[model samples]
Target: MQINVSTRHGHLSSESRARIVRKVEKLERYFERLTSIEVTVDLEHEESPTVDLRVSAEHKHDFVATGRASTLAASLDVAIGKLEQQLRKYKEKVQNRHRTSGRGAGEVPSLAEREAPDVDAEDEEI
Candidate 1:
């Protein structure tokens, strides 16, 4: 996965940048098809540090998590935690949708069945 860490008002040290990479590597265990990881730390004048994370994967679903904290590392921790929850929820939703849509579809008679009319049902209705 590609990880880009950019600080808006302040510069991040090499150690901090490495920590960010390590923080994101945990996601690999959850989602193996990650395409890119973008982390932007915005330091506004007199405002708390805000970390915005945008993680993209091959599935075309984007997982975003934003957090503001007194410290950059704190903000990053919150953002990553939120992303973990999002990824799990996203996986569950996709799995459920596929399961429901692909299964139990052929069990019921469709509208076309009534339109064409089976001989027994047609005669009974008539």
Candidate 2:
């Protein structure tokens, strides 16, 4: 997956950028076909150091996650956690739908067997 890191309203350090790359790289273990990710880090100039982590990935559909924390690491953790939940839910839903769509061999109706009509009740019409 290609990860693009951007910082707004603050000077991003080399370590901070590397941290984001490392964290996003780990997502491949869960979803290998990830297309891209965008991470935005903002440091509060007024009070505490607040960071926001946002991630976007491509699969059967687009998945997005966002979270804020006092630290960049914590924020990234929450974002990844949310993404994991989404991927799991997507997988389960697809599996459930596929399972429900299948019909067993017993459910098949042969043309002759289905067209044979009721011999015993043919005399008594409904």
Candidate 3:
């Protein structure tokens, strides 16, 4: 998967960018079909930075999360956590969609196998 890290209102050092990329790459473990990841850091407010994480997966809408914290690392962590939960939930849904509805083979008889009661015989006996 491709990871693109971009910043807004500020610049990040090479070491910081590398660290962010490393941490973001771990998200692929949660969803193997991920196509790309985009990380955006907004430093408009020096004291509190906001991190926006967007993950793209095969045959799925983009998963997005935003986190604001005192530091860039903390914000990124928060965003990653949110994205992890989203990916997990989506993966579970996709897996479950293919499963049969908890019904075992021959547990219930088909309509054609059911016999109609003898109404005329019951009336004669009454």
Candidate 4:
């Protein structure tokens, strides 16, 4: 998957950028169909940095999450957690939809078996 890490109103050191890339790459484990990941860090406020993550997957709209914390790393972690929860829930829903056809494998009752007991009562009266 393609990963782009961009900063706003500030810059990150090579080491810090590398760390962010590494962490973001791990998101693929949650959903293999991920096509791209975009990480936007807004450093406009020095005290509290904001991180926005946008993840795109096959046949789905982008999954977006935002996090703000005292440190950039902390903010990124929070955003990752939110994205993980979203990906997990979506994956479960997709799997469930494809896993079953809304019917069990057991044998279905015949038309006679489904009829009401009035049929048996009429026969008994005859």
TM-scores for candidates 1 onward, in order? 0.75, 0.66, 0.79, 0.81
Model 4, C-alpha of 124: deviation from truth (Å): 15
lDDT of 3 by residue, 15-121 (tens): 98999999999998899999999999999998999999999999867999999999989999999999999999998998877664677667887786588676799
lDDT of 2 at 66: 74
Worst 10 residues of 3 by lDDT: 96-105
lDDT of 4 by residue, 17-126 (tens): 99999999999999999999999999999899999999999986689999999999999999999999999999999998886667765566768778747677788898
- Model 2, stretches more than 4 Å misplaced? 45-60, 104-126
Better of 2 and 3 by lDDT: 3
Give the per-residue lDDT of model 2 (tens digit) for 8-110: 7787789978987887788767655567777766675424344444445554467777767667777778887887787777767877788768786568778
Evaluate all candidate structures by whole-model CA lDDT and list the values in order: 0.86, 0.71, 0.92, 0.93
- Candidate 1 residue lDDT tens string, 1-126: 889898888888899899989998888777777899999988874257899999999968799999888888888899999999988887788778988785575787778886784689878888
2 or 3, greater by TM-score: 3
- How much is 86 displaced in model 3, in angstroms? 0.1
**In model 2, which residue pairs have backbone atoms overlapping below 3 Å?**
none
Candidate topping TM-score: 4
Can you rank all candidates by TM-score, best first? Answer: 4, 3, 1, 2
**lDDT value, residue 74 of candidate 4:** 98
